[model samples]
Target: MTATSISPKSSPDRLSLSELEAYIRTIDTSEYTKTRNYIGGSTQLSEYISRGMISLPRIRELVLEKNSFSASFKFLNELAWREYWQLTWTAIGDDIFDYIRPIKDTVRPAMPEAVINAHTGIVALDAGIRQLQTTGFIDNHMRMWLAGLVCQVAKCDWKVGAAWMHSYLIDGDYASNHLSWQWVAGSYTGKPYLPQQDNINTYTESLQKDTYLDQGYGEIASMEIPEILLETVDVLPAHEATLPEDTVTLDGLNELKNADTILLYSPWTLDPLWRKQDKAIRVLLIDPDVFSNGRFSQQVIDSIVWFAGQVADLKIICEPVKNLEVLTAAIIRKSYPGITTWPGIVDEPEMLFPEVPVAFYPSFSSYWKQIKKYSMTDQQSLF
Candidate 1:
C-alpha cells in the first residue's frame, strides 16, 4: 500500500469524549436496554485514539466514568489490557511470542467458512460481525458473542478471529483482542464462557429462536454478562525501546544530509498512517495488516498494496509471539539488505521488572514518563 494516498483526513470521523458523554446524555434513562447497548456496546472511543485525536489518558478518563462500581472497573480493565500487553512484551522480551503460536495452532488449522460467511446461525453474532465489517465497531457484549462463535461454533482459532478483528476495528488493542478471545476459548485466566442459545436470545432479538433448539444451554440460563475486575500493578511504559549506543544524535541527522536509509517500524502503538514521514525510503517493512495477518491475509495484501506501493521486504512479527529474529530472517530471505526490525527495551537496554498480570498501574505511572516524550525531537531514529 502506497502511503501517499492513505490520508488520515479522508478517514471516517472518530468519536471524542465530549461526544460520547453527549450521546449518553441523550439516551432515555428508563430504557435500560439501550443504556446497556450504547454504553456497554460502544467502541467509538478507540476510533478516536486510532484517528490520533485523543490520548490514552483521555480515553481512560472518558471510559472510566464510575457511574457504578462495575462500569468504572470494566472501562479501566480494558485499558489495563493494553498496558498488560506492553508490560508482557517488556518482561518476556521475544519469548512473549511463544505464548501466541500454540494458541493460534490449536484453534486455526484452517480458516472456517461459518465465520467468514457469517453463517453461525447466531443472529447477534452475525450482526456483530457484519457491523464490525461495515462500521468498524461492535459492542463489548457482541465481541464476546462473536469470539465465542469463532472458538466454539466456527471451530476457528481465537488468534485468527483476533487477527481479523484487529485489522478491521479502529481501536483494536493487541492485549485485549488476543486475551479476550483466549478467555472465551477457556485458555485465559477463567473458565470458558460459551453463551447458550437462550442467553443469546434474551440479550439479542435478531436470532431465529429455533436455530439452536437442540444445542444444550442449561448453564447459559444462569449466565450473566461478564464485567472486568480491576487491580493495581506496576507496569513499564508502552513503546519503551532502548536508545541505541551508536544512535544518531539530533545534530548528526542535520549534519549528514546524505545517509541513504530505508524506513522500518517496530510498531508499538497503532497509528493508521505509520509510514508517512519516510520521504527518503520507498520500501517500508511493516505488518501489512497492522496487528497480525493470520486471518485476513488478502485484506492486508490489498491494504499494503494500496498504501505502500509494491512490497519489497515482507517481514512477519506478531507481538507477544513472533520476534525480530523471525522477522529478520524473512527480510534477509527477501534480499532486503537494509531493513531492520525495531528492538524492544527488554532486548536492548536489559532491565529487570515485575511479571505482573494485567492491572491498573497508578503507582508506576511517572517512572518511565519520558520514554516517548522526546518522540518529536528524535523522530529520525526509526527511519
Candidate 2:
C-alpha cells in the first residue's frame, strides 16, 4: 500500500495540514464500505498517511469531529490494514521483503515486458501500469489486478514486482508494498488472489472481453500464464534515489558544532508539524538504509523536499546511515523504518492504536482481533 489520483481537495504536489483537515471534514466515509473496492472509489488518503503528512490518530480526531464512528468504520479498517503491515515490519524487520507463509508454485519471477511497457493485452491493467508510471498512483484494486497478473499469472517471486512497484510509487512504504505483493501471490495470506477479467471490468469500468483473464474463478485459477505475459525483464531497484551534490542546497552539515538539537525527517516520516514549536535544526535526513529492498521515485523525493520546506529552516542531508556523522550536537529523529537505531533521541512513530500485538501474526484478521480488544471502547471507533 506504499501508495492516488483523486488528489483530495488540493494539488497533489503541495498540500498542507490545513488543506487535509478541511478535506476530511466533508469527506463521506459512509459509502466507503461499498465503493472503496472500485478503481476510483477510495478516499485517496494513502499517499498522505504513508508519508506522515497525516496519521490514523489525526484522521480519526478530525473525521470523528464531524462523522460518527460507525460512519467511518470501514474507512478506519482500511487504515488499520495499512498499519498492520507496518506493525508486522516492526515485529520482524526486513524479513517482510521475502515470500512467507507460502501457498504453492512460487518462482523467482521478473517483470513482464508487456507490463513494463503497458502493452499488456488486458486494457485495464495496461492503463493502470501507465498511470502508475506517469502519475505515481493507481487504485488499490487496479494494483491488485496488476499484482495478480505479475505474480500469479507470471509466477515470479513477489519481491521482484514488489520492488519494481515501490521504486515508482509516490507513497512507497516497503512494509505495505512488499507484504501486499506477497498477499496477492498467496505467499503471505496462503491463498493466491486471482482477479478475473469480469471483476476488473466491473471495478474499472472497462468493457473489453475475451482476454486471457476472461474466465470463471475455477478456470482462471488453473490457467497458465498467457503468452503475452511470458516475456519478462529483470528489474533492479533504482539505486537509492539521490539528489545530486550540486543540487543539495544545505551547507554546514558535516559539522553541527553550534546546533543545540537536530530534529530529523525521513522519507517515511515527513510530518511538517512535528516539533514545530521547538527551536531546533529541522533536518530531512536521507539515510539510504531507510529504503528497504526498494526506493522511492524522484517525484516522491521532490515531495519530501516540498514538505520539508513547510517547516521553518529545515535542511536536507543526503547520506547513507553508515557514512552519516552528527557529532557534538544532539540529534533526534522519529523512530522510522531504517532510522530507528540512529544515535539520538528517537521517538516512536505515533499510532492510531497504541496496543500492538505481543506476538507476530501472519494475517491481518488475526492481528486485528488482538488490536480490536484495546479499543477506545466497544461503542466507539478504534481508530
Candidate 3:
C-alpha cells in the first residue's frame, strides 16, 4: 500500500500507551461475525493483532464479555486460525517455507507480473493488490483469492507468490503470511483452493465476467491462466525474494552493558507493556539476519518502528544475534532467511497453543478441536 492509504482501517493504527486500552474497550465483534468473508468486511483489527499491539486473549475477553463462546465462535475462530498457523510454524520448525504437500497440477511456478504491477484485469484481484501496495492492508478474503489465483489458477508456486505478498503486508508475520499461502496452494491442505467466478463477484461485488475465473467450481481445477495473467515475474524460489542486508545504524547499546537483566525483543515480539514489572533493560533487537526472510516495503518498516517506540526506554540495535553475544554476555539473536530463531531465550512466541505437538496437524479444524479443549484460555481471569 502507498503512504496516502495508510489509515487505521487499512494499515496498523499506532496508539500511544494511554490510547490503546481505550481502543481495546471499544472493539466490537458483531459486524465481524455478520460479514467478515466479504472483501470489505472484517478489516478492522487483524493488522493490530498481527503486530502484537493487541492480543487475542484481550480480544477474546472483550468478545466474551458481550457474547457466549458459541455466539463469538466465528470471530474467535478467525483468531484461532492465526494461532494455528503460528503453532504449525513452531511444530514444523523451518518446514513452513517448504511446500508441506505437493500437487501435480501446477502449470507455472512464478509470481505473475500483473500482481506486482497491480494491473490484473480481474477487478477484485487488481484492486486488492493496489490496496496491499498502497495501504499495507487488504482483507483476508482478498489475500486468499490472490494467493489462489497465483498458485491454483495461474499455476505459480505458492512459495513464490507468498514471498511476494509478504513483502507488501504491514502485518507481515512469517508464520501467518507463508502458512496461509500454503493453505491456498494445496501444499498445506488436502485440496487447492480455487475461487469460482460467482464466489469472487458475490463477495467482491465486481460483477465482471468472461475471464478464466468465470467457471463453475468443478471446472476451475482445469482452467487455463488468462493471457493477461500469463505474463509473470520470476520469483527467487517463487522468483528471488531478496532479503535486505541488516544495515540500520544501531542506537547506542553499549550503554546497557552493565544492566542486570536483558529483556530482548525481536520484530516478532514488540509490545509496550510486555514484562513491564520485571526490572530489566528492554531492547528492540533489529536482527536483519533473523528478520530478513521476506522483503518489506517502507510502510511495513515504519509500522514496526512505530510499534517499537511504544516500549519505554527501548534500545534499538542493528546487528546479528551473535554480534550482540560478543558485545556482552547479553542474549544473542539468530534468525535465518524466513524462519525467526532467537538463541537467547527458550520462551516461545505468543500462541493460543504455545506448545505444538510433534506431529503435524493435517488441518486447522483438527488443530482447533484439540486446542479448543483448553485454548479458549479465559483471559479475563488473568485480570
Q: Which candidate leads in TM-score?
A: 2
1-383 per-residue lDDT for model 3 (tens digits):
00010112222455664566566555466766778888778745765666666676766766577665665667777877877776777677788898887777744767788878877778888888889888788888898999988887778888888887887787887888898888888878767788777898999877899877888877877756777788887753222233322333223334455566677766666666677787776666666654455556766777676776666776666567665555354553322223244556544444545444635687987885666554555643212
RMSD of 1: 13.7
Put down candidate 2 lDDT per residue, 1-383, tens digits, no spaces: 00010122335555677887898887778877789989889877887887788777888788778778888888888878887888888888877877677566857557888888899889888889888888788888888888888888777777889878877887777888888898899888788898789999999888989988999988878888789978888765353555523242233643344678878677667787788788876666666455433456666665565655555566666557544463566778887664556667888877877776545688888887777676655757466
Cα lDDT for residue 314, candidate 2: 60
What C-alpha lDDT do the candidate models reach, one value each? 0.42, 0.74, 0.68
Using Cα atoms with residue i matched to residue i, what is each candidate's TM-score against the true structure?
A: 0.52, 0.90, 0.84
Runs off by more than 4 Å, candidate 2: 1-13, 237-251, 288-296
Residue-level lDDT tens digits of model 1 in 314-351: 22222232333332221211111111134322111111
Candidate with better TM-score, 1 vs 3: 3
Higher-scoring candidate on TM-score, 1 or 2: 2
